[model samples]
Target: MADLAQSAERFRVIARGKLADPRIQSAIDSSTDRLRSHRVDAWDELGEVEERRSRAYEIRMRAIRDIDGNLERFRTALEARGGHVAVCATAEEANAYVVDVCKRHGAKLVAKSKSMATEEIGLNEALEAAGVTSVETDLGEYVLQLENEHPVHIVAPAIEKTKEDVARIFSKEEGVEVPPVLEEVTASARRQLRQVFFDADVGVTGANFVVAETGTVVTVTNEGNGRLVASLPKVHVVITGIERVVERLDDLPHLLSLLGRSATGQRLTSYTHLVTGPRREGEEDGPEEIHVVFLENGRRNLLDTKYEEMLACIRCGSCLNVCPVYRKTAGEAYGPVYSGPMGAVLTPLLVGIDQAPSLPHASSLCGACTEACPVKIPLHELLLELRRDLVDEHETSWFERLGFSLWSFAWSTTFGYRLSSALARFGHRWASRFGPGRVWASDRELPAFAKKRFRDSR
Candidate 1:
């Protein structure tokens, strides 16, 4: 993927195509609206949403501030319970570790639940290259996997796919006719995945929160796939970012209370699996071996920086629900793994500003994401900071720099300001007819310059 700052024409073409598709537009709008409305109602029911958000923010910040110590403590605790821990500092190391694990166990088939961490590292592609068949058990993820696509929303992976689309995908996969009915499509998926659960040599999942105090790996899910994937296979591996750790188990209630409501409007999800370790000696059923891979992947670089607050994010997807840019273009416009307001800030941070120079400019700076965040991350403010960083580093194009410099020079003096204003007023009629103005006016009406100044009248 070429940097959009350098490939503006190509990026605009892709964005325009997505915007022109009515089905894509309708799907994104409906899904985000519903989730946004649900979150508001859920917060209203809580009656203490602000208080809970503040507490959650504090808990997350504390852990991030001392992330090295927290991760060390977590490692010791998990190791005490006979669980193994691997701290990977890059995507390559993480992928290599997971592949080595599969090779060591002689595993051929792996069952996976919804995990954005795995998506970030391209775990599925790595597994396939290593000759492992990784099956997605989550319905939305399964649909996306079959469609050869990645998730669009953090919570709703296949939010753009309708029942009819799903039926077509399922029919192709099953080698049979399937109706577009919800129940039938669901049954068809269940039938195909049931054997996968029994036959998979390993199961992989992502953690919602990791308790440093107890070394518990917590996963929240609406579907029951998370529990099955963890318990059914002989080996269970957890892949997650190091920022997910909280200093204490006591912090769970505050964070958990807001996660479901903010993400999906449920007071709590159907399953909140807290796995301490592998199955005990007398356990009837559970994975015999448990492994936790904590991925840094540029997360450590944010510590002690101005953008450190971003680590407090809990993947609630509340910000994405309210982001105007995301609702219009979806996740593909941002990147493959993360999208929306949080993605706009985190992507550039994780991947370096030079590589993704255009992401910081993806937002409208409306501050809705900050207001909707469960942990109170100032998302819009961080985006503005990123833009400043880009300017300081000279990553922006020469055209942009010249335009801004000219504007600043003009506005800094009364004579230049008056002259520019006069030019703008006189040129207003032709502004929408060509160049950048033409493109801006393609979808939106160009604002008209006022004929008279209020200061003169005063």
Candidate 2:
């Protein structure tokens, strides 16, 4: 996997190339538009959408305020039900714990649900290095795995892929000719993964919410793969961020209402699994050994920071659908596990701003992401905050600092402002002879200066 700097640079190069591709732009526009429409319709159906969002936000705030206490309570309750909990401070520690679990169980094959935490820590890569096969059971995830690609969207991993792209991947994987028909493609994947589910020695999943009150791990998936990955294997391991813990069982309904509506526009997902613990004596189909890994992975550092509201995200992808930047470039452009507006804020915090210096500037700050957020995270404000922090840290180049300094000086006085406007008009006239004002705007002309300033006209 690419490190932060490499990833950000790669995104810049790839995004520029993708911008020239009509097919990519078309696919992104169509997919996000459909998701956006569905989200609006779903919220309308729920009624009192704003009220529910406020309630959910309050619950998230309360839960995060005392996150440490809730985690401890969750551990106590889970252990009482014969479940093991491991609190890992870093990705290496989390991966080590998972590797140890596989080793202890003599696991050769592991089936996995679609979990961004797993992707974040490179779990599959680690498992392969340990001589185990990790299979992605979710259909979208399966397609991505076959293509050797990362997820493009949080909920819809392969949203950027076309049906023909999927057909090619499935055909190559199955060593047979596959049609591009949606139903046919799904059936083929289901047929192939069904046996893997039964044969895998261990199952790995991520929880949507860990109810502290019941010590239950709640997983919501449209596909039944999450259930299979959690239940069919003898050992079931959950890897998730510690921020997923909620204070009460009652809080789940409120969050779920927003999650389902915002994610795929369903009132509720097709499958919602609440696993309290490992199988008891009389229990039949659940895993025999249950282990929950709460990964800190830099999250604890953000608890009291200005960006704590980021923890309120449910990985709905609603922000991505509505974000102007994301719609045009898609998730790959962000070059992180989390993408879009949330990624702009969280990636820098988790990975450090120096590595993703350009991410804060990736937004138009149109506030679409903030408006679409189910928990009402002020994403645009967070982006601005990140930009401010970057400047404070001196992460910006001297050239940018000089330009901003001059611009600030110009705008500070009336004479300077008027003079700057006249200079700007002259600069625009000469811009064509010199070169494009911005590299990305080479094809477009700078707007003509107004005939007269509004203030001067008045």
Residue-wise C-alpha lDDT for candidate 1, range 34-61, written one tens digit per residue: 9999999999999887788888888999
Instruction: Please give, for residues 15-46, the per-residue lDDT of candidate 2 as tens digits.
Output: 77878888889988998899899999999988
lDDT: which candidate is best? 1
Clashes per model (N, Cα, C within 3 A): 0, 0
TM-score of 1: 0.96
lDDT of 1: 0.90
Give the clashing pairs for model 1: none
